[model samples]
Target chain A: MPGQTTASLPRVAITTGEPAGIGPELTLMLAMQAATLPAQVVAIGDPDLLSSRARSLALDIDIVPCRPGDDLPAPQAGRLSVWPVSLRAPSLAGTLDPANGAYVLDTLDLAIAACRHGQASAMVTAPLHKGAIIDGGHPGFTGHTEYLRDACGVDEVVMMLATDQALHGVAHGDTSCPLRVALATTHLPLRDVADALTAERLERILRVLDGDLKRHFGIVSPRILVCGLNPHAGEGGHLGREEIEVIEPTLNRLRTEGLDLTGPLPADTLFTPRHLATADAVLAMYHDQGLPVLKYAGFGRGANITLGLPLVRTSVDHGTALDLAGKGTADPGSLRVAVSLAADMARHGQ
Target chain B: MSQAQPCIALTLGDPAGIGPELVAKLLEQRDVVGKANIVVVGDRWVWEEGQRVAGIHHEIPEISSLAEARDQTGPVLLPTSTIKPEDVEYARINGLCGTSVLEVLKLCMDGASAGQVDAICFAPLNKLSMKQGGLKHEDELHFFVDHLKVETPVCEFNTLGNLWTSRISSHIPLAEAASHVTSERILSATQLIHDALIAAGIEQPRIGVAALNPHAGEGGTCGREEIDIIAPAIDACRDAGYAAQGPFPADTIFRRARDGEFDGVVTMYHDQGQIALKLMGFERGVTVQGGLPIPITTPAHGTAFDIAGKGRANVEAMRHAFDIACRMGRHHASR
Candidate 1:
């Protein structure tokens, strides 16, 4: 429907994360709706686990076991091409086992390798259980972004969440543009958010946000709206000094280098349609400031994209939903969007 | 005028700001005039300037005192102080204008104390102007607390449509927000909003408290504020018989509230609730001064100095402020 013939469709590799969680069923659900998707999706997990989950969910897809770079059949419903990896321990739905933790990491490593070797155009990931991975003996397991950064040997990557659902009439300068929010700092205490924002860090984050919008999103010169660390953007130092000391200085230096950046504006007013309508992306100073609004605007329908990466990777904006795993009611909306976004980014590269 | 109508004292917030023009736009609406016995309290010349900026005029009768305005319905002007139209500097903060704004609000507060007014809905005020106008307190709420001699807890409740939010710490440094997340403050904010929502006609409001840390501290790996501070305060709220839930992660809690999961949310700091509420509806948000003896409300927006005297301020927030004041005033009147 989007002018892609079946042979020319880009290949998207999806990892079934945290086998005990809803990742397997969500993957199977995505495969069943392959005709509506923009790319050829290959589920990179244990073929047996997907088959079991598919049976439980009553899906009628044929789980064809294939390898990376295999000549897969044309896109069709009820036909899933799986680059099979064996599970170290059999996984049960709705039950987390640390024994299968390495299995989860194995799936990710395989997807990364495949994408690196040109076997897949891009990779989309479902949610993984951090606790299981940590307990299964990788003590420094922080998150998927950190894992990918380390696996790829990159110094840093920006976590940006976006949704095709238009926030307002003029959101992102168009009625149909997606709202993208990238954080300068992630997963620190509220008290530590200020200390984490140095001039160097802000410069690097802004550069990455700007560069990736051009390289990945196809925006030639991205206009990013930045948020200040303090309330009312420090209200000209009556509220706080971060805007004066750190944010403004960094933005001024970058602006002279020809970056189209605005604000040190108030976070409360920055997310409004008046300002958001003019941004390609927003760089919030911390996690809570930008995310709460983005999630509220596009929860359950958003995709989490990792910028500054050597390869294009997108993930669902939600979690594994361990409670609703076996119940077959977990929504595949985010995974579908993630795969669709990854497909778009792959096409952009081409 | 009908005795059934409650008297509302409306002040032109900061003469330099767009408050006067917004109040002037609000007065042109016939339905707002018919709902309450509206008394416009400010300098007569400034009120006329608002009318001129708004490009509208009304023959509001002049009242010499609050006692005269108490019995009259429709829009009545009580010129407590004088500022000439030529002396008014639009969009520039002046001590004289600030002092005049404080005096006008003080008169209304005194009238409210004397039972001469049921509610007070003022236009947006400039904090720096008020401070330059000789305000000793950090903000107007503190000034009101001192003036009204309120010994109990007080917080500002921001409402968008049906969802209400109150914060424990506001107008402080982000670094210091964690230090203010004590159990005592959270309970105080919860109690205040719970009572205020009831007074505003919500029966048994369910309040959702936000976690102070990210992912609710991820079970104390990231920060201890959620475990050590926020949860205990939420427990205290439950024991106190208020329908309260969560120390939910700040990011997703607002979505739940927006989707009708809760009637209100009590946040640990300002931007946690503000970033969500303003994004949800910036033009329709109203700020209600909670735990006050008399009902007080204002537009949650500030004095838009960039567009002051442009005669194009959106009057929806101002109108909602008036409607809330009238609603709360009616409840206060019946009680």
Candidate 2:
């Protein structure tokens, strides 16, 4: 439970994901840099585990243990603020133990509760090994984003990977440069991407993407580019006609609603440097179709953000590297970016 | 060879496939080196083994640069390999062989970018073989696009008898393929095909757009895609000065186009055009990446991993790929 008071600072709950992965290391790394962050950050995991991780990584951070109803501690210069949620069993550095799955879930549940009760302004989640989490009896949790969605009771969410590129601006300011992409359908088998692209679904996704871009990134009217489902966008029915029959009408409908949108362009050609330079974001047809390009563009440095959620949430665009766990060598660049994005979005005040 | 022209970097596709054999058979053509410089971008041992199996006696040109083969006659080989040729077993997917193939493509593309090579032609590479090679891309073309960061729309065009260019869906699931058909996409594909044909020097190319459902939806009784969506798009393209016609029954459209009824056919999905074109002239089929700054052409077949190490691969498609690449390259160069 979080402290209740008017003066209680808004907390940003961080879930140190799967116990045996790089989650603990990344959490410790971010904790080292917590002094520079603006929001109140809290890690819902064991304090001793974080301390051990910090020691292994050669990081010096004090661990402030808190119980339920305890006042959130002011983040110290070289210390980690922890809301202790003990693990059931001892965790090995590289091996995933099924016994700690409930502990991971409990951490997330506590963080979500903090956000729901207005104790936390937003949440930054570390990577979790989905397979281990599933094998640990929490059969429904697929990935961190899905788990967050269900925990927050959001009906639908779009995953966007954002990165910044320098551009000639009107003034000497850190321009709010973001390359945002939202998928019409995600995590589906490749065979199902086309049938799943309905006009209604596409319209909804575009609308949500537009709204989120405005709210989170402060783009007044973000230009949305769409990739066609078929090859050559159906080659006028030569390759496939999903573009002609399905995608066009949906775009037409969106156009009538006055959205700045373009395409049904061939997916193969949509990711070129010239075209990508002209649009604010791209709405990809499916997972593999769009993500390969995005991942290629910003592999380990991109941040995964969930739109259409009630609270601000951003995460590292990577999975729990069980192999690299406990090595104290996990890259904290993405975690730092996720925290920065969460703070930025919170400042924007959706 | 005539003035030692720049070699067209060619990739010997899958080791288990027909790529090695195809390269062997292609090199046997005396006139191939006469057209443009040819460089085989693959393992030297693989080429030698292919030469032995194909029973073609030709000296493998061992040179680092295309300029080295400038005055010499016969095909030049720029050997690239990740593993020993002896290590690759036929018909089996080997990650090393796949990675080698990708490395070859990357090297060739790099050379082309630096003006070291004039153009490139690819032999078929198996998708599964590439997966074994640890490639994360959907296809070779996608890999190129990612590497180059090309902005122009790279579309796959299959030229059947130099008469029609067809495609709709290239690589996607069938269920998803149908829903992707849209009026705007049809219009864009029609526009690109029309522009490609005109650029190929055809004036006002006649294009036939195929219907998604059977019989152009039999006037909406069979399906509404033709009546409700496709027909309107065809009309829009016509208004834009393209001689586009269709929502024709997919079954008969290809035949009509074959009979000189239309200059090209707009297909609804991958197999729709591929089936007709492959049947018409599978051996002579050529693939063109339209809307690219440079016209990129390749043989339609992939590396035949099964017969790759053996020298039984056909060279007709490779020959056609070269012919088309040369023609397109010349056309673009002149422009």
> What CA RMSD would you report for each candidate?
2.1, 21.4
Candidate 2 CAPRI grade: incorrect
What DockQ score does model 2 reach against the true complex? 0.07
Return the DockQ of model 1: 0.80
Docking class of 1: high
Clashing pairs in 1: none
Question: What is the per-residue lDDT of model 1 for residues B1-335, given as tens digits with 9 covering 90 to 100?
Answer: 33367889999988888998999999998888889989999998888888899999999999988877667756899986645567678888777777888899899999989888899999999877777778888678888899999998899999999988999998887988989999999999999889888877789999999998878899998999888888888899999999999899988899899899988899998899998889888999999999889999999998888889989898999999999999888888877
Off by over 4 Å in 2: A1-11, A67-77, A166-177, A298-300, B1-335
Put down candidate 2 lDDT per residue, B171-248, tens digits, no spaces. Answer: 764566656688877887888788888777788799999877644555554457777778889899889988888877
Query: What residue runs in model 1 are displaced by over 4 Å at the alpha carbon?
Result: A168-177, A298-300, B1-3, B80-89, B93-96, B333-335
Total backbone collisions for each predicted model: 0, 45
Per-candidate Cα lDDT values, in order, are 0.87, 0.71
Superposed Cα deviation of residue A128, candidate 1 (Å):
0.8
